[model samples]
Target: MHATHSSGKGRGHGGGRGFRGAGGWQQADLPPADDAAAWLTGRLPDDWFVGAPTITVDREEIVIIGELAAPEGSDDNSAAAAAQGRIGRFREETREARMQIADEAEARYGRKVAWGASIGETKAIFTHLAVPAMTRLRHDERRVLDTLVDAGVARSRSDALAWCVRLVGEHTDEWLTGLREAMAEVDKLRAEGPDL
Candidate 1:
């Protein structure tokens, strides 16, 4: 999923130092996104399935986002719980797989590559709650949030900002979907080209 911040800056550097692992791999040496996706797909258990994976290169990590497939014949509640449990049980295996990928990435990119995964619907399988993070906002941005609070859309500035985010997401669901699809395609194309 594309993360949005009021500052219009992404959380991590795209295609920068983070993408290159310190071990020796440079950006050019890193495997193509498609190749990484295929490896992950093959490594994961058949029972623990996922949709097409999208790879994101950040300053400190490589994130693979996919729809974690729910167990068949289960209701939403049971399916979610089951998925969580399964993921928890396989954490070690997942880490090993990620390390293997990281090794490859580091060898090729000349930097350390950290890997992460998200469950179906892009929900983090491990983190249970939203942790507080600090970000500096411009005067006008803060003012806009305060105005939203005054308007009664939320109880506080933070809540108001969250409300606005949800509203934007709801309204631009289709556009977001398209953007994700486009990113996947770009990954595939990058894989087909020469390394780097």
Candidate 2:
């Protein structure tokens, strides 16, 4: 469920707004200055802004980067955000400033003036998971689990696995049965790990 735009033919993925090309830095085609305020009058996408609450007028372009109103019918709460977006197609001051910045940056970094880079793919962004809700033990298993929790051995599924890896398996008459039972318990711990 993400909006995608091909910024360039070669740039097929990445950038929150369907930007796909390597060279095509898509900017919203703004209307005249008078209508500029009206441009953002209606509902805008939730994540369109790269900056917010301040609009800067440059020599060449109007650089307005900020969070916008979330579109209607959105399931999530679309309050104002500190997101950003930039408009420079019609202004000159912004262009010069950007060029100057790029020149300085390139000189500093010793690289090409590759100014507009398509944002990284949103889907590829890594995320952290909650660890507490992963494993659920039965009533009888709960007593033992509480002890492990107290010992800080299994705060998450990964923690549980680490604990199991260090386990001294019980010695029983049927070695295979004991190993099988231990493995079964490990499986449950893995599926319900807190970091899911």
Candidate 3:
């Protein structure tokens, strides 16, 4: 049996276009994460093993992370290769379907959407973040880095700090945006308000 799961967090408008689902596939208002997962599962072939997906919404993008497995009973070497090949073919064949899903997700959440999958084991994907060269951390901040290292979330103190920064960025994205807008409004008011 094939099953899929998905989880996502974001703000949504009331209406969106029809999203394809496992059965008849229906149009709904603000389709939840489970519905999205079912829709994606329906698009995949019967042989694929799709794991639970973690979805994240950034300013302009929705990211989907999940694991995919080869068809069951394909343990032999040749069968394993064939299964891998079929997985690749599935990805190619479903390109348009993926785009459709992305479009629907973007419309529903008001953001662009991109997806990435891992065939088996999930590995960390890294992106570089630039910071000032002369920056220094306080003693307490250094202890926090040490704690993260002790927790094994990162390989080193620098990595631990980077992970912490990334976590903060992910969790506070919407709040940061709202803060920026509020600041912009405050600036406008300061400039345009009646001079004392």
Q: Candidate 1: where are CA atoms >4 Å away?
A: 1-48, 58-60, 66-69, 72-77, 106-122, 125-138, 147-196
Ranking by TM-score: 1, 3, 2
Model 2 TM-score on a 0 to 1 scale: 0.18
Candidate structures ordered by lDDT, highest first:
1, 3, 2
lDDT of 1 by residue, 114-196 (tens): 43445564345332224354667899999999998888878997787778778998999999779878866775675578875
lDDT for every model? 0.56, 0.37, 0.55
Which one wins by TM-score: 1 or 2?
A: 1
Q: Tell how far residue 160 is off in model 3, in angstroms.
A: 14
Residue 153 in candidate 2, Cα distance off native in Å: 54
Pitting candidate 2 against candidate 3, the one with the higher lDDT is 3
Measured against the true structure, the TM-scores of the candidates, in listed sequence, are: 0.44, 0.18, 0.36
The TM-score of candidate 3 is: 0.36
Higher-ranked by lDDT: 1 or 2:
1
Off by over 4 Å in 3: 1-49, 71-87, 122-196
